[model samples]
Target chain A: MTDTITIDDHQVPFEAGQTIMEAARAAGLYIEHLCYNPAYQPHGSCKLCSVKVDGVIQTACTMPAIAGQKVESDSPEMKSRRKTLVEMIFAEGNHYCAFCIKSGSCDLQALAYHLDMHENSFNHRYPVRVIDASHPDLILDHDRCIFCGLCIRASRDQDHKNVFTMAGRGKATRLAVNSETGKLGDSTIAADDAAAHVCPVGAIMPRRGAYSTPIGERYFDARGIDEIDNASGKL
Target chain B: MRSTTPQGNCDVIQREPGQKIRIASCSLAGCFGCHMSMLDIDELVVEVVHHLEYCRGPLNDVRELRDVDVGVVEGALCNEDNVKVLEQFRANCDLLVAVGACAINGGLPAMRNHFGLTACLKEAYLDAEGVVNPEIPRDAELPRLLNRVRPIQEVVKVDYFLPGCPPPAAAFTELFTALIEGREPAFDEDMVRFD
Candidate 1:
């Protein structure tokens, strides 16, 4: 049997263990995803990567690739749904990009641009959160966290430090430190930890790296994030 | 292609046929980044002049406002003068297009919105590390400042919005083409920016 699947018309070949997203990405396709880091297993935290497989919508990261399965992405309807997802996430957080250290490189901001979120489809919630600067080398600005679980996955799966965790229910839910002191400085998280480097937003930042890269020189400055299709690149 | 009204020497318009469109522009409490970006259209300005004529803006030395077919406004409304200029543009133009992030959501100037007006003034005039005179300007001749900087939509009805720190020149080129062709201007994902 041919180990190929059709995604938005292109025939993508896949290996036995690769997920639909992994296969599509390997074939140089850009699927809108926020939470599926290649280093970690697919968590499916953000549903922006939803694609139609055999006329049913499914998250691409968790779906396994199969030969002859027809997958659809980049359709106007799918694009609209992805746009709505981005808008909802944006409204739920207090992400002000102008002053954010990760302004140019923020994944959420880049996604918003990619989806053409010209104006807020929903009203700005303006919810405020505290900035946790207790960490010596890294500061956790809770306001910017979209609760995507990248830090949680990175800390636990990659660092094996379990320095971060989720707590509370629904709206009250938040990213929390695992230390008894409830402060990042009190935790074992170091500036060099892989978890500290994995935040897609400005939430987890090294103290002195802000503004090190000048504006217009950073990612997604003059070009869209999808301009290049590097098979090994992280979106 | 412009022709002055022989009767009303004050009013000048295109002498050509009914195809010419008048356009005016204004800059508010901003760094004029949008204007610079517009100028980046380069030699295409000659082609643009063939369709649209300047009414009142820094593009010319004219210090007065005139009736126009379209008004392209940039920057945030931060002071009383900005409000007056915006109202003038609204009153004179048939359509108003808010250009750039400042016109869309108040942009960087609206960063002051997080802090109250008094606190911002105090920090800038009295409390800043390098401040010397430490006096908030209260001259009667000066325009009064707004409590917070606001987007153009906050002050007047905006027909369209082009979002960017300074939207790329290609965006302006596309917008002008659409407008000149009598179609609704559109911005795709490639042309808009949040940061």
Candidate 2:
């Protein structure tokens, strides 16, 4: 018999090693998340995917799928908690979505839309971050980063370049390059590397690649993130 | 209804009776796109007109800002004029609404916060690839620019914020409807489209 788990009352079938995120995605269910990728081990960093697992709050990305396990998602309380977490992300970074190249298709922007974020209710940190334009093919705008560690994990875990790491902690934490110079151009992050593309926001995007797709024609334009590839963990 | 032109019976303009919600709108250091989005309400603008009267705005040439029920300010607070306008909104209206990303968090105009005001002017007039007397414009006629572009909330107490470059038209409709009905303007996920 196929082992199945219940997520938000939907019976999701999973393999032996599948996490709740993977099972939900396999069943075409959308569990809001940011940092858990299927290509690598699940890392619960964003916490936007936090759901009630057997009546306790647990990250769906990290929780292993147990047959008949009850997972509660999409509740009003869950949405409120998720909204708070997303609000914190907006507060942490100066996410100017208006002029951003990744404005239409950005996952963070899409998620913000999904969460009905009409205002950045939290105090705006307005951290003056650097816009690194040194890379030949890519640009890194640290202003919009939420420090989800997707690039950090993807760099070391999948690309094997060890090109990204999180330096500092708490509010001062920032995404850093692996090279001695600490610049993206100085690091081994190529334009096509998995690390380069794992950024959920506009922090990492190809140079001059923005606005190529018009406002209404981008990836997340007409359809939400759930419809397009599950957007599961930058995978 | 108010503003209705009486036919040949009389030359009098019969205005709407009773208490109509007063609205005041302004565009600060912005592209005036939000106002355009406001107009994008299409035929539904008639509904807004039915409920509210324009006390002061670009939609009409009304100059004086009376006691308004709602103040809609669009764009970032960049120069002295912008500040004056924002303060006027606060003093004139009971509820102040920041209508776009620019008003909420500085938006595109606030991109100059990174380069500083001096560098921004120099880059535009002096450094850009151009040939001429590339000098920054300085005159008493122009409003004095602030050190950094600031969001409207930083300058005044904003009651609500509608996020977007210029926010969608539907968002404005929802907010207007909610405000007209004396309910809180809370956007659901389906109504949020930042682009």
Candidate 3:
């Protein structure tokens, strides 16, 4: 008998060491998330994937899947909470989606659309951040960084370059380059590095290729994130 | 129906049977792209006109903002005049709808929020390449610039928000048709976009 967990009334089978997120993804169920990419170790920083497991709230990416356990997601309460989390992320960063290069393909923007976040409920923090265009091929616009640390993990674990790191503490925490000058140009990150491609927002982007794909042809333009995620079967 | 007075007092305004819904619109610190999109409703304008009475919008030249059923606002509040106009719309209209991305999240104009007001003014006026005579305008008649550009919702209560760069004409059609037919307005997934 397979160990199966019920998520939003859907039976999702899981292996012994699998988390609820992995189980749900394998079952072709889409759970909204930002910091829980399957390419690296799950980091439950975003809290957008908070689910009710046996009537208790827990992060789906970190919570272990158990047989006969019922997880509550896709409910109105859960959706609303996820929307508020997205709104807070928008409020914290200077995400002007109107002109952002990653407006269409951005995971944060796509999740916002998927969660039906129409207006930001929180006041805009408008934190003053830097835009590092020092790299020959990449531009780091810190204004849009959500601090998911996907780049840090990808660089350290996958690329073995250690090009990125999370510096400071609390609200003052920021993405820092591992170089003497504290600039991306001085770092060993390449344009093809996994760290360069793992940014979920517009914070890290390759230069000279913006808006290459027209508005209607972009990802998330024709399909919602849920549909795309289900079709791709990736976490 | 109920309306708010300029003094911020609620007043009952009786609407006669078979009366058309009145609408007013304004553009502040944004481009008139949203108004252009509203106009792109094209042939549907004839049908819309039958149900709505234009009071003070780009379609009409009326300067005074009269009591209206819906007040559509486009753009962010970047100056004192924009703030005054938004307050006036809030006072006069029963339902205030933020029309586009500018009114909802400050859009492109709010990009100035990163640089301080002095820096922006200096860049535009004093540091530009074309320097015949660079001087920051400080005329008494000119509306005083706010320290930061803000979305309309930051200044007044907004009942509805139509998100997009300039919300697609289909979105307007949906909203207006729903309003005219006395149905609750809800956007399709494709209709709501930040860009």
Candidate 4:
């Protein structure tokens, strides 16, 4: 028996428990994703990699690609809906592109621009967000955070230290520091932790060079990140 | 249906060489970042001025107001004065534009609303260390603060909303062109941010 699946009319083999996104990517099919890092477990929050599987939009990162399963990626309807998902993330979060330290290079803003988000179509819901400056070497701007949980899962699975946890629910749910004092400084996590750098927005930034990266050479446009092979290059 | 003609019935008259339009802008109870972004229009500023009237404001040089075809309001109503200023702009100009997040959704400054106006003012004035007069002003003439700052739409109906912390420069250009052409505003999909 073969562990394989048919994706977009192509029969592709996959390992057991492998997600449709991973299998598709392995087959050289590009699926738009921001939250799924190959180096880490899927954070499935981005919803950008959503593809029609059995005629339903589901996160490819978390959803397993099965045998004889059908998948669609390049459809016009899928493209439009994907763009809307990316836009919703831009609107829900306090993604101030101008004031953001990660402006040019930030994944969130870059993805938004790439997806062609010109105006915020949704009625603006400016939720009250708090900034955490407890950690001396790292800053956590909750407003810019999209709750992707890359940091949270990375800290637990890779670092062997569970430092960050989600607190509250719904719009009030926020990433909280796991420590006796409930402050990031008191946590066992280090400034150079994989969790710190995994932040998509300008949320968890190194203290010293927090805003040192100039506007032009920052993160997104001309100064943007090398997204092609960042996992292997930086890791 | 205030204007079936869209914006106004005025037609673009032929102008001699170097002739420009006049424009006026203001920033009230909000960070002037929106104005900076407006000025960031760079060469487009010259183009905007060519077709509109421009006037300097009583406060900042960048801030201005004049009787013109369009009046841009770049802040939310935090007090009675804001209401009056909005009404003045609405009355004086054929078009009123709310620019940026401050003008659109009250921006970060409106975050103070969670604390209420009195507590916010008290925290800055009375609770602070060095102050000539720590006492809250008992004057009746001065405009009293609202319970909370709200978007311009809440106080008065806004003609157009260009939402962003400061709207993207590209959208700014498109909106300006649309306004000048007397066409319905174009909100490019590229300018929309949702999250």
Compare the candidates by TM-score and give the number of the best one.
Answer: 3
- Stretches of candidate 1 exceeding 4 Å from the true structure: A2-6, A11-18, A64-69, A91-100, A167-174, A214-217, A221-224, A227-235, B1-19, B46-50, B57-67, B77-92, B116-150, B153-159, B177-195
What TM-scores does chain A show, candidate by candidate in order? 0.94, 0.93, 0.96, 0.87
lDDT by residue (A102-163, candidate 2, tens digit) is: 77667787877777667665656677788888899988889988777888888898899998
Model 1 C-alpha lDDT per residue in residues B40-116, reported as the tens digit of each score: 98888898888877767887857577768778899989999999999999898777878887776677887676677
Model 4 residue A114 CA deviation (Å) reads 3.1
**lDDT digits (tens) for residues A17-84 of candidate 3:** 99999999999888999887888898889998999999999999999999999999989999989988
| Alpha-carbon runs more than 4 Å astray in model 4 | A1-17, A27-34, A67-95, A118-130, A223-235, B1-24, B36-50, B53-71, B83-96, B111-116, B151-173, B181-195
Best-matching candidate per lDDT: 3
- In model 3, residue pairs whose N, Cα or C atoms come closer than 3 Å (at least 3 residues apart or on different chains), thus clashing, are none
Instruction: Assess each model's interface with DockQ, reporting 2 decimals per model.
Output: 0.19, 0.30, 0.44, 0.16
Residue by residue across A5-111, what tens digits does model 1's lDDT show?
99987999999988899998899898988887788888887898999999999999999998889999878988989988987786566666756788777788888
Please say which candidate is ahead in TM-score: 1 or 4. Answer: 1
Superposition error at B120 for model 4 (Å) = 2.1
Could you estimate the TM-score for every candidate?
0.76, 0.82, 0.94, 0.74
lDDT-best of 1 and 3: 3
Docking class of predicted structure 1: incorrect
Ten residues in sequence with the least summed lDDT for candidate 1 chain A: A226-235
CA lDDT, candidate 2, residue B164: 79
